[model samples]
Target: MPKKKSTFFNSVRFRIMAIMIVLGIVPSLVIAKAVIHSYEKRAVSLRISNVRNQCDILCNQLVGVGYLENPSSKVIERQLEVLSNVYSGRILVINHSFKIIKDTYGLDEGKTVIAADVIRCLQGEVTSDYNKKNKYIELTVPIKDPEQQEQQGVMLISISTGEIASSVELLERNGMFFWAIIAVAVVLISYMASRVLVKPFNKITKAIEEITDGYQKEDILVEDYTETELITDAFNKMLNRMKILDESRQEFVSNVSHELKTPMTSMKVLADSLVGQQGVPEELYQEFLQDITMEIDRENKIITDLLSLVKLDKKASDLRVEHLHIDDLLELILKRLRPIADKRNIDLILDCFRPVEADVDEVKFTLAISNLVENGIKYNVDDGWVRVSLDADHKYFYVMVADSGMGIPEESLERIFERFYRVDKSHSREIGGTGLGLSIARSSVLMHHGTLNVSSKEEEGTTFTVRIPLSYIP
Candidate 1:
């Protein structure tokens, strides 16, 4: 269960769901809040306007009928009572002397009322205010004498906001209920959307799991999105490469077993023949021993070449690098293989375009170049020429080994660097070739971050070019 929770939190689906929820719900909530506050503000403004209009009418009547001077009008008094009852508020009608002539509540009649709103209204400026905490609206309206163009008195009104408060409460409750439904809908939609979006990735995962579990080796197709298509292509390429490597490993093991067993079998046969003989001739016995010894030597050579290939295949960090003159290096390699070339009556030549220096592992570099030059001599026609050339640019040094030899077949050129691959098997065996020289040489060049390429034509000749960086990176 804990693992499942961790997986969910880390998954793309959860992130998508979270993003959708935030996008869908947060803005609606903000707008809803703004809308509620706006309604309240607009409602208060309209309420204040209506009350002010009524007060203005009453103030006009007071001045026209001379009601403030008389103070005994039952009609005006009843009207004031009705207005106060309708609005559930208090109203005070004051004279120019600041003496209240009529108080609807009858609590402050004949008394002086001194307030900033009233004083301001008496000076021809109407004033109004709302106290949110107290839930009330307060305002003062002026009584003006029209012909005189002067202010007579101020009528102060304080109205209860309980009605607006009730409406706001109802709106808030309804809003909460509406948002509850919206929140649930948002969550459901986000969850469904996330699941739909991640479906292709889940399919890709299942396909990969099947491959890793050894249940399937076929390529997968998930083109629901462009990203999924790219992933599918990359995965299929990796799977195909793994398949090729697996096949190569199995073939290598089989080849190693066969090659190792053949020499042993021959030696066993030679030993058994000597043991089975009652009276073998000294000369024949010596000949049989020589044959057995040759098989043993062949087996040893195969083992040695295999070990060299293994070492070359190791990490490039194992290289013991040093700067050496590349032209001189090529000269020394040719000198070492000159004896073999002389035995075959092959001319070994070295040409240096200019003196060059490069960082290299001397032992591995020598082995790689010697194999090329020796192969040139070993596979050449009688009295054929083998030329070793050296050249250099700013970044890299180049070596070319060209020989007048029975060149490689077109099909065999590609597999020449593969282990135990030989172009002419019979001739290779006759010349004591173990077929690992090219593979070892290729591995050595690769370790130094270089490339070895070959071009040849049948019964004509072959040319091998080696390029290595002047400086070793590692």
Candidate 2:
């Protein structure tokens, strides 16, 4: 038994399923990441705006109450502390001299704190910076003297982004769980869809298998897809062709048996007559011997024709192709068969339209054309004409043999090329025909990758046309 293929990885179903899974999962991951990052950004912006507004209000109060110079106000200190605690951050109030007047954490109150953000704020610029890695939003808000409209101090604050981080982490966990469910659903759906899509092919395979095992003889129909329909149609055509070939083979064998036996039976009867006689006359003996010899010759002709057919049935590679003048070839063929035509007083004629050359197997091509020409002559009326014509074009040359003879019946025309098939069996036998001439001729033309076609009408005439390419293809 042949080794079975890996069911999942090696199959079309697996590839389709894998593509679906990737399609389903990749986009989900991208959208989830984008949503989470957007949330983090929005939350940070809102937190920064809220804290900055509160700082602005406090700085206005400090300027109005003269608290920067006083350094001690119960209301201002309480408000600053409440703002710091609300956002989980630290605040620093700096004077014009860059001294920390009040630190919400109470650690840097006596220190001289000089930072880039603090200096920028004192120059009347409000600035904010976000540190994603540190998870904080830093801001610097300027405090100004209202009457002079000049900078007095700066309020610098750093707010923690711990809440945003926690929210993002939670969203990520939920998204992962949701994506897992969707991934499972997609895999299941894709697997089933793949199987459904491939079902028709499986049916076609099963139908072929049943035919191979001799369990079924009917043609298959798979219309699930256009492709499947096309495949089924092609297979049916091939199956029908095989059936026809098989029937032809059987018919050919049966005809061979009957034809071979007829000559043998005739010879046996002639021989038995002489043997059973006590005193046979010398003239009578000669006649019996002559009859016996005639039967033997007929049998030999049948065998020879059969052998020729068998060789023609062999591969085309057996042909020894050569370049030859087609007009000259036809003339030579007609020359050889002129005596036979003359015996019946049939006017044998050859008409060449133009000089032509072609690649052909010289012996096989000659045999095929010779058979056609001979048939024209043998089946012609006494004193009637048989015309053999040769014509050529750029790519192909044509040979046509037309005879004014007893034409074939329309019904028998189709089967004329079948081995041992005869239009008129009695007439064919009288003319020493083995009924294999047309079949051999056709096979020879086919071997050279050419075509032989015949057209006829009863009691009128018959014409055989052979078309061969100027250059042999294979």
Candidate 3:
């Protein structure tokens, strides 16, 4: 239970609730304090006013009877008693000599109360004090003869605030009650707001989970919000890429199985032919053995090409880059394949507009260029020619291999770079082609941040263009 509660406080809901509480409560506390303080001041003010009015009246009656001249009079005592009862506090009457002429409480009668306020009252001033914490009101007013315009005596009053103190406390309690209700409302609002905000994300998570579990077939739909839409779009794109990779992997496995099986099947048939033919002619046996060896070599080449493709597909594969003459590279590739070209009487030519130097993977680029030129020679007609061209600009070097071969069909051009894709399966097998040559060539060129392009006409010829940066960037 404590674990769940701990998680809840760490969750978005709690953080949002905490924020709302601070936003709602800090100001409320300050406002309540101000209100209580103002009530305290107003309570003191009202008591002072009430006592002032009663004291003024008593002072007038005393002046009319000349009570200060005779403090022991019964009439003045009765008036003082009435003033004390009405105001609910102490009352003291002081003469101009700063002597307590009359005291309603009688505790300070005949005492000389020579206080600052008493002296100020003797000089014809009124003063009041209010103690908010203790809750009391004190006031002093001077008695004056209107005709002579001189101070005759002073009236001082003190009032208890028992009712006001109790009322202020009750106000605080009621304010706190209202605040409690407000806090509950804020909690509910924050909870609902956080829930509403998080609903889309929850839906997204559920949809992704379904996709992961193979239950969902369609892209996640959460376009009600921009942020969620962006998340959904990115996730769906990555999902689609994974799907493509999975399909490609399955296809690759099938193709590899089929390709490997074919060579083994051919070797098996050749072995069976030797086994059945007892005392076979030496020349015939040699031919069969050569055929078996060729098939084995073909199998090895296919495996090698597959490994190369896998390396090229990786993001972190490093290139052994070197600055070498592009012209020399092409000559080296053609030199190796020239004998095969000679067997077909196909003309092999190098049309170098200018010698080009580029930073490239020495062995990989030679293999890639060899694939292009070798294909040209292998697929060309007898007495036809294969032309290799090297050209360059400030930024990039270009290699073009144009051939007088039976070119690829227009529709098949795009799929030519796919693994094990062949336009003419019979001719490909006859030429011992694994159909991965173009794919490897393209991958190698692209690894150097280059481009491989082809333009061909069916039954006429084909031209391959290779563009590579003059200097490798990485």
Q: Judged by TM-score, which candidate is best?
A: 1
The Cα RMSD in angstroms, rounded to one decimal, for candidate 1 relative to the true structure is 3.2
Q: Which candidate do you rate higher for lDDT, 2 or 3?
A: 2
lDDT of 2 by residue, 1-474 (tens): 999977768888888888998998899889989999999889988988999888888999999888889977999999999999999899999899999999999998879977898988888888999998898899998898767898999898998998889898999999999989988999899989999988999999999988888834889899999999999999999998888898889888999999999989998999999999989999999999999999999999899889989999999999999999988888898899999988989998999999988999988898899889888888878999999898988888999999999898999999999888887878788888888999999999998888999999878889999998999999
List, residue by residue over 1-474, the lDDT tens digit for candidate 1: 355555888999999999999988888788788888899999999999999999889888888888878978888888888888888999999988999999999899999988878888888888889887889999998888878978888889999998898898888888888888898999999999999999999999998998888935689999999999999999999889888899999998899888899889999999999999889989989999999999999999899999998898788889999999988888888888888888879999999999999999999999999999988998899999999999999999999999999999998999999899987888788888788999999999998999999999988999999999999998
Worst 10 residues of 2 by lDDT: 211-220
Find the 10 residues in a row with the least total lDDT in model 1: 1-10
TM-score for candidate 3: 0.85
Error of model 3, residue 319, in angstroms: 1.8
Ten contiguous residues with the weakest lDDT in model 3: 1-10
Against the reference, the lDDT scores of all candidates come to: 0.90, 0.90, 0.87
Per-residue CA lDDT of candidate 3, range 125-178, in tens? 789987767767778987877667788888888877778889988999998998
